[model samples]
Target: MPTQQSEPLPLGDTIQRYGLVSRILHWSMAALLLWQFLGMGLKLTLGRTPLVSFFTGSHQMVGTVLFVLILARVIWTIANRRHRPAHGDGLLGLAARAGHMALYLVMLIVPAAAILRAYGSERVFAPFGFQIFPAQQPEIGWMVGIGDALHGELGWLMLALIAGHVVMVGLHQAMWRDGTLQRMAGRPRG
Candidate 1:
């Protein structure tokens, strides 16, 4: 007897666009990154207000969560790399790839530095009330120094990269007329 064949299951990435998992990770991280920046921006502008407290209160915990999500996203990207949409050809493609790499590098570094500092610091880091790392004696001055030196600077650099990413997306839509945003957005503009 002949057996019936079934259609292949859809994947989480495609040459034309991103899939559910990729879109979710992209938007979720975008929101979290925005939250981090918003809190910092408010802190600088508004000083010690209740609103700032509300946002800044969860900053460390959220950054930790973002770090984990980013790691997962990177793994997912690697797994889907072959099936993913092309960055395109020539200098524009090279720029796109470089920009994305820079973004990913800074994203990983900023939080990793902070977590490293927390691990080596005198204060216990109980993100969401669960102690991940117990307090250390005398603190690891070097670790804290690394965090102090890199975290904020790399964070601002990440912000600049993010802004460039956004502007490039806008340019893709406005000038190039490429459906670049649709890769993560899931739908082309009407």
Candidate 2:
């Protein structure tokens, strides 16, 4: 006998049906991103203080968490992608995939640059002073300077990338309306 085919899940129903692991990762990442944004946003407007210290630590912590979670996500995606249900791979889908790839690249690059910058500066910037990234002696002063410049420029780049991500999501939701957003909107597989 042939294998049975499952029905397609309805739009707007993805969020309520996301698998446990998927939901957990999704919400955790979302929450951390929110906090990180808040931390950075405040740092831009608000002056330094004990409160800023708290948020900064939180932001760094969130960044660290994102690194680990993204690593896990990447591993999980690689390991189980074959088992994942198939979806369209057309133009809009290609755009979505490319956009996500860009996001992940920016995500990894920005933190790494920050880590290298911290290491180059011998700052040992740790979350809550825990020394997450230890100092390292690189080639020369130019290496350190380059790391710092890259780190700062990447920060600006990340700001734009984030905005682009939001716009893309909005476009997928508003313009496409083809279940692109719904698929990842925490919905369950049918």
- Top candidate by lDDT: 1
Which parts of model 2 are misplaced by more than 4 Å?
1-18, 83-87, 128-143, 188-190
Best by TM-score: 1
Ten residues in a row with the worst lDDT in model 1? 3-12
User: What is the alpha-carbon lDDT of model 2 when measured against the actual structure?
Assistant: 0.64
TM-score of 2: 0.70
RMSD of each: 5.3, 6.4
**Per-model TM against the reference:** 0.92, 0.70
Can you write out model 2's per-residue Cα lDDT over 23-122, one digit (the tens) per residue?
Answer: 4665687678777777777777896777877887676667777878877666655555555434447986687577667767776776676666566665
What TM-score would you give candidate 1 relative to the actual structure?
Answer: 0.92
